[model samples]
Target: MEKFEFTKPELEETEGILNHLRDTINDTLKPDDELRLREQLMKAIEEGHIQRDVFGLNPVLQALRTAQIAVDEIGLKRDGVLATLLFPLVINGHQTVDDIENKFGTSVAHIIQGLVKIHNLYEKNPIIESENFRNLLISFSEDMRVILIMIADRVNLMRQIRDTEATEAKKEVSEEASYLYAPLAHKLGLYQLKSELEDLSLKYLEHDAYYMIKDALNATKTSRDAYIKSFIGPIEEHLTAAGLKFHMKGRTKSIHSIWQKMKKQKCNFEGIYDLFAIRIILDAPVEKEKMQCWQAYSIVTDMYQPNPKRLRDWLSVPKSNGYESLHITVLGPENKWVEVQIRTNRMDEIAEHGLAAHWRYKGIKSEGGIDEWLANIRSALENNDDLQLMDQFKMDLYEDEVYVFTPKGDLLKFPKGATILDFAYHIHSNIGNTCVGGKINGKAVSLREQLHSGDTVEILTQSNQKPKQDWLNIVKSSKAKAKIRLALKETRAKDGLYAKELLERRFKNKKIEIEESLMSHVIKKLGYKETSDFYKDIAEERLDTNTVIERYVELRDHDSGVRQAESAENFEYESPNEQFTRKNDDVLVIDRNLKGIDYKLAQCCHPIYGDDVFGFVTVSGGITIHRRNCPNAPELRKRFGYRIVKAKWDGKGSSQYAITLRIIGNDDIGIVSNISNIISKEDKLTMRSINIDSHDGLFSGNVVLMIDDNSKLDALIKKLRTVKGVKQIIRI
Candidate 1:
């Protein structure tokens, strides 16, 4: 890599941003490391072709600003800073993974690569299904810094969105941020970022609602300030008397959050209560933090009537994201509800900055806090088999967790609504495979029983019991489902193999080679989608051997051009010993010799060579062949049984029979051309004519084709059915 010199104007802007970033992290970063980081940032900007606009705001400049925010606000380290700086180059297609890894180290390069993969997934599958979204989280789990950088990047984008002129683009970005990024920020415990992202997104997505709430909040600000002062005065005095050093602040809810409450409650803005919260941050040592929080909570609840249902005591057991607070909703003056939150100063920092602040404040690299959560997610991803990878990832990321206890009193957490079978599998696969039922809280229950928090479950197992296919539907965990599917598939594969051996034996007795080609032919003729399905039917005795033999013979004979034909021509009575040789052009082979007999095909049924037929002697015509299942067959057969004559085809030569088919489909442009293309691909059929009519965006057409046999015609019809815009096809 070569270092490029920046122009005087570019150098000035770059130096200014770097100086601000250095000052913010002067205490944290080593002096030499700071200089190196500055050099790397300057080089990346130059190589990336970053330039300042008339207002001195370019992509590179924006990236620097994001880096500054990540350090000063988000509490990120060196790797995160590098990621923020280089993410712009990756997004704009200016740099590759190799370039980043060679110029920087693997740590920074890997983060950028993961971010790029996520970006590509979103771009390629914009209407991302839940499964793909889960995969996005799994990508995030690879490195915690990836998400930190992403949040910082989004915060900067939301801040600059007012400069965007495209209304549609703004709406799309805002909707995505609202639906995905904001919830993610909240889940990660970054309350400040979550609030900002939601407010910015609402400003774009629901402009009217956002402004209305904003204006309402502004109008009430003066009165709200007065109320807050009055409400907190008593609590502040009590806390000061308790000798607790603390700072209190009144926090208004974001406009977006207020709008959400209004919509959810189906009320006007003024009808909503508790639009703001009061926070009491105690300056306490680590040992006294929990005690100080509860003390504040008691003081507030005593001064006002507390809602029992709304009290959340996280001091005992913090959230998975390490959020610890004591929250209580109280009825205050004027019968209005006010939510009060109490936490120590350290807890407040963790709430604002999330995992980064926790790690920085704790001074540990890989600890038991967030790393444990990441480990569990990785474990699920590694063990998953049947369920989609994204689904497993989503389960780990976003699903509500229920904590259950084992018989030994060991607590285990699982996704809410997990069944007893999921519990059994969580213990061990063998235990699940042999599980019959379980006892929840010492009461007998089926495996399908949904476990709730704090329930003690004991799995009952039988040595002879194996997993059933239906267990898949009963279990909610991906692990149990994967195990059940694996067991069933193995059993089914074995059965299929046995069935194949039986079929092969029968084929050998008939002196026919049951090769792959022959198997494909038989499977298709029998209407089986897969060879395994055909074999399974045979092995399970669901298919009759005689039916299989008959179909096989038919397929073999068809391949050899030995079609068994039936005739519908009648002849005058002849002597018992009489015999006659007929020309091969005769469509039907008459049982009785009928030399020079004047006969014609029945116009009503238009019997073809492959059709079943019988002869009917007409008074005017010599004889006419009528199909067995023809519309007039029953009447004719009942009226004149004696006049019927048995007939058969010579089965020696081939000739084309004209057939008309009706087709209907949407009237799309070039639909006829598409149908014609399919017809041209079939070598066994000759398209004689076609007529199409289009009306009201619908097309109806009749196609006239000349085909050799029923099989060829059937194949042609199947092929035509696949053409684009073709809805229906029927032989007329």
Candidate 2:
């Protein structure tokens, strides 16, 4: 790449950033190391064009400035600082991995390479895909400092997005930041960055909402400031008299959060009352941090009446993201609700910067707390064995979490909507496989029961109660789903082996060698796509033994001197009248008196009772009922005109017809139960079974039902369609 000369203003800005970087790294980096890094960074800058400015700073300078922020604010080490400075060069395609490693030693080069890979992966794949998202995290896992640097980079990007000219591109960046990066930041406990990213994203993605909130805040700034000041006055006096050293500041809710509240509460900006919060940062000794926090809490609550339900004491048990604080919403001056937060200086740092500050302040490696969270993510990525990978990963990312305890008082964390089955799997795969149900707080609950925080759970299991394929649809955790799939696969493999052995033995007794060619023919005749499927069907007794034997014998005979013409003369066929008279327990009884018309539901349209349907007589399968508007209906009506039979529901048949319905909705806890309750409440309807598949917050399922008439079925569907969260319902 050709080097471009820096303009006068660009040069001044670059120098200023470089000076700031030096000041930030003054105490951390060794003299020789600092000199080498400075030289390398200057060389890289000289050899590349200042293509763009990020937040009014040149890209190269912005990277250095970000590195400085990581060092001073986030406490990244020397290697992290060096890597951040060089990452922009690698990302912009101005430098190669080999060039970086040869010039900047192995460690710095490795970090740069990891950052570059993450950047490229984000560019190539949608962030919503679990595989790509997991890969992004895995890349960061290699070097924890890479996460810090990325956070810094995002902070700078969010700061600069307002200057982006292209509306579409800006919106795209905002959405990604809001959905992916912001959540990641929150997970890491980087509350400051998370809030900024969310606010900036909202500014672009929902410009009108953002400005409306912003303007509302500005209009009330004077009054809010006065309220905060008045509210803090008594608390300040109490703390001062008690000999406590502290500083208090008023904080306003972020634009994004305010917008979220409006949407969730279905209220306008004016309806939002607790828009401003008060923070009291105490300079407490390390050993007395907890005690001091409580003392401060007492002082504040004593001055103002506190809402017991609104109190959150993270000081007793910090959040998983390493945030520690005491929060209370109190009745403030003028009878307004004022939110108050109390934390020590150290706790405040961790609350702002998250895990990075936690490590820096504690003087410990950033592994123990964050590693547990990362391990969960890594396991999800490594063990994903199904098509629901994206959904499972997203559930981990976006869902609120609940912490529950075992009978032994051991704490476990799960997603908010996780059921007892998920808790079982979290205990052990064997436990999950054998789980029948469980007790929540000594009260028996179904396996599908959604657990709440602080519940004491005891799983009930039986050796004979093995994991069913349907369990995959019931559990909410990736671990539970993965274990179920593995168990099902193993069971199928064993059954397939037994089936193959049995078939081979039968073939041997018949004086026939089951060659690969013969097996292929058998699979085709059995209407199976794979040999394994054929064996599995046989093992499950889904394929009739006599049918398999007869088909194999006919195939063998035809391969030899015997032909179809010779077999036709010897073949005994049942009369159409005899076949038509065979009773089916769950078949649709076509017209009131037309009881003996043999028919099968057409797979093409899967006609249900409520569907407008007609029967078509076929040469082999007596009659096939299809929905009137089925894709195959028009052709069947035109080509098989004579075979078409006019059919209508008599609405008085005693027998019930099996029908399948497709349902889609927003995934929520107890959604299946809600749907089931609706079906079970109807007097004439019986639900045969249901299978649900969900990912993210969306669920799609198939419900099999037995109904007597089209009108009743239609009424049932109408009731189901009205259920909360139900988006679409149709006969499948």
List the RMSD of every prediction in angstroms. Answer: 16.1, 14.5
Please report, in order, the local distance difference test score of every candidate based on alpha carbons.
Answer: 0.73, 0.74
- What's the true lDDT of residue 127 in model 2? 38
Worst 10 residues of 2 by lDDT: 576-585
Per-residue lDDT tens digits of candidate 1, residues 154-184? 7877787676766766677777777767766
Q: What's the number of clashes in each of the models?
A: 4, 0
**lDDT, candidate 2, 499-578, per-residue tens:** 98888787677666666887688779666888778888788865644446656766787788785343443334334222
Q: 127, model 1: CA deviation in Å? A: 4.6
Shift of residue 525 alpha carbon in model 1, Å? 23
TM per candidate: 0.53, 0.58
The TM-score measured for candidate 1 stands at 0.53
